[model samples]
Target: MALISPFLPPGTINNVPQPVLTAKTLSLRPWTAGDTPVVFAAHKDPAIALWHRRRIEGLEESQAVIAQWAGQWEKESGASWAVCDGKGLVVGRAALSRINLFEGDGEVGYWTLPTARGRGIASQAVTALREWAFDAVGLKRLQLTHSTRNKASCRIAAKTGFAFEGIKRSALRHEDGWHDMHLHAAVSATPSG
Candidate 1:
């Protein structure tokens, strides 16, 4: 029942119930109903919501999201996580959304809680997700997109080895109308014999 990333190295594993990636003081664990509050708080920050599509309303909405995430988790088609701090408070959210097995690809999306910003949490979360996608799901390539103005997100991608692929004009519609986005990707390294 585990997913095999057809394009990854020979030994990649996928869809385990435990964490697939970890950082110095943080961990990325699968999203659950209890994590909704963290997700809600993270999205409350204007900086985090600027690039995303819709805004979260209140606890009720968060609950609904958690429900949907639970459903997705059951299927193994996509995955989401609540990034926890050393104290275990939900500090952010990260996801490997839009996975396509036939195409051997996945897209990463993430946001750090406002209070957790400027501490390298976003980068760590992104790195963890990329490792999972590459070594767990065995995706041949992983892609990320950030509105051109979202320099911090772009930097996160670059810091995690996602090479700048290109810029797509008017690719995303934010609250401020259409915006340009920079695409970045990390391709699997061919293993040596």
Candidate 2:
């Protein structure tokens, strides 16, 4: 009789892995309904209102945006995430949209709660998301738009390795007048691990 192996274990199955991302004391994860309160407050913050699109007036509007984001994520064509602090409180949002799959391009957008500003959180979040976009999403280029007067966002773009492309005339209609938008881009065609 042939000798049998002593207690050979059978192959075990592996469960699907959970998506994870980190940035200093902050973490990035897909947006969810639970983030509505934070989202509402952030939208109403004066700093965000100065350069952002129309303010989300209430919880209902916030919830609608969340639903839209969820649908976009399900389509696997666009993405947005809530930025959470060490305490796991959603402090803001970061998004990559207008995804052009054929060209491997997308636009990056972000905002931070007023209390979280000046902490380098936006810069850190953008950098982390840029890496994820290039590596996980196989994107070749990422773009950003900054209002000419929004010095903070322009600074963040520079700090995050995005090169200033140029300015687009009448890119946005603000309270004053049509605002020129500064374009910034990062081309990740070079191999990155």
Model 1 segments more than 4 A misplaced: 1-20, 190-193
Error of 1 at 13 (Å): 8.6
Q: Please, what are the lDDT tens digits per residue for candidate 1 over residues 1-193?
A: 7484344332233344636458778888777777767667766878877878767889889889878766665555567888888887778878877776656777888887777889999888888888877775667778999999999988899999999999999998999899999999988774512
For each of the candidates, give the backbone clash count: 1, 0
Weakest ten-residue segment in model 2 by summed lDDT: 6-15
Instruction: State residue 114's C-alpha deviation in candidate 1, in Å.
Output: 0.9
Query: So what's the TM-score on candidate 1?
Result: 0.86
Q: Which candidate gets the maximum TM-score versus the true structure? A: 1
For candidate 2, what is the lDDT? 0.80
Candidate 1 has its poorest 10 consecutive residues by lDDT at 5-14
Q: What is the lDDT of candidate 1?
A: 0.78
Give per-residue CA lDDT, model 2, range 4-46, as digits (tens): 4312111110121224568888898877788888888888887
Q: For this target, which candidate reaches the highest lDDT against the unseen true structure?
A: 2
